[model samples]
Target: MTTTFDRGLALLGAILDAELGSAGYPGNAQLAARIGLDQATVSRMLKDLAALGLIERAERVPGWRVGPGYFALAAAAGDSRLLVRARPLLRGLVARWHEPAWLSVRSEGTALTVEAQLSHWSSYVAAAPGARTPIWCTGPGRALLLDHTEQQLAELLEGVEFIGGGPRAARGIPALAAYNSADRLAGVVVADREFEHDVVDFSAPVRDPSGAIVAALSLAVPRFRLADRTAGIAASVAEAAGALEVGAL
Candidate 1:
């Protein structure tokens, strides 16, 4: 039986799907059409869900996206052992540095955040699990791609448009390839104002027992706040990544 609760859940799931979609977030009209509901009904339902914190208005964007509550529920229900193992490490990163920390894995040529530990600051970067970012640009994103060969990188990035990031973001595959080469040598990635103009990210790849790159652990901070502290922050991210790798296995 199609109950009211099921319909609400369906709406929430649809919004989350669009939030993670490469095509970008869907507005009310689009959501209504997709769900086969009247625009007025979708709007009322969205308002109710937003009030409950299941979804929210996308920041500076034109549509609805899943909220922290949704992620909290999803995390509780998820069965991934790695996510279970990573939560403490991410929390530790936040507790130590007072910065947001994230655990992300490669998905469909993008980096999909699977876990996040947010800082307690009144103003800080807002990232939630299920958010996706360009694999060629962001810190965790680049770290996730550190093991790919030049040809493999090219193949994966084929048809991808390099757009909508801060000034330092890689503008092309060649730039990403160069950055990855350097990251491979250094064993970490520092995305300085690459994903967002005011934020910087330090990340390291997390490898499994078989030495395969499975995820990336990252710490994000404001660019101004990172002054003269880059090295220590990068080292901490790398160390935490190592711990997560062992703990996950």
Candidate 2:
């Protein structure tokens, strides 16, 4: 027999499934239909979940999404052991360079930041977890595409308008391709004043045991702050990424 607890868990699972499955965030009606529950019941349960921070109400849209509490639980329980290992690495990078470090994964056509480490400085580039940035310009975004073929890149970018980002951001396929060529040759992505006018980023892919790119690791520094240490920072970022792959896997 299904218990109340079971039903509650089922509702939560349904919400996550809908979001990850590309059905977008499910509203009360959708959740009600999905889990065979009354709309009122679903609403009450969602309120409870939101209170617990397991989920959050969507902004600018009608639906729900994962919240920081979920990430906290996952990290605490070793559900995402990779991220646990990444925390120290990110800290070390920040300590060494006094720049911000980020861990990201491709979410459709954008790069979704899953982890971030900020420096103590008053002035520094920072991105919080769950922030999404354009794939056509950001270092972490480009790093995630390092293994894709030209055709795969084209297909992924199809219907995506080349807009936003700094003035140097890629405005078309040709420009993106040109940037990709240099990145591919270097085996890491170097995005200079692309995602943000004053920030420069260096990123490398994080691979799973099977040698497939699962995510990207990046460090962002203000252009003025970077000075002459660009090459050193880039190489260190790449090395740290490799270490993450090995240690996590």
lDDT of 2 at 193: 84
Number of residue pairs clashing in candidate 1, backbone atoms closer than 3 angstroms, sequence gap of 3 or more or interchain = 0
| 198 Cα displacement, candidate 2 (Å) | 1.6
For model 2, where is the 10-residue window of minimal lDDT?
A: 121-130
RMSD of each: 8.3, 8.5
TM-score, candidate number 1: 0.71
Question: Global lDDT for candidate 2?
Answer: 0.80
TM-score of each: 0.71, 0.70
Residue 155 alpha-carbon offset, candidate 1, angstroms:
0.3
| Clash list (residue pairs), candidate 1 | none
Local error of candidate 1 at 160, Å? 1.4
Clash pairs detected, candidate 2: none
What lDDT score goes with residue 213 in model 2?
87
User: Tens digit of lDDT per residue, candidate 2, span 16-97?
Assistant: 8998998999898999999998899889988877865678988999899877656654553453777877888888888899
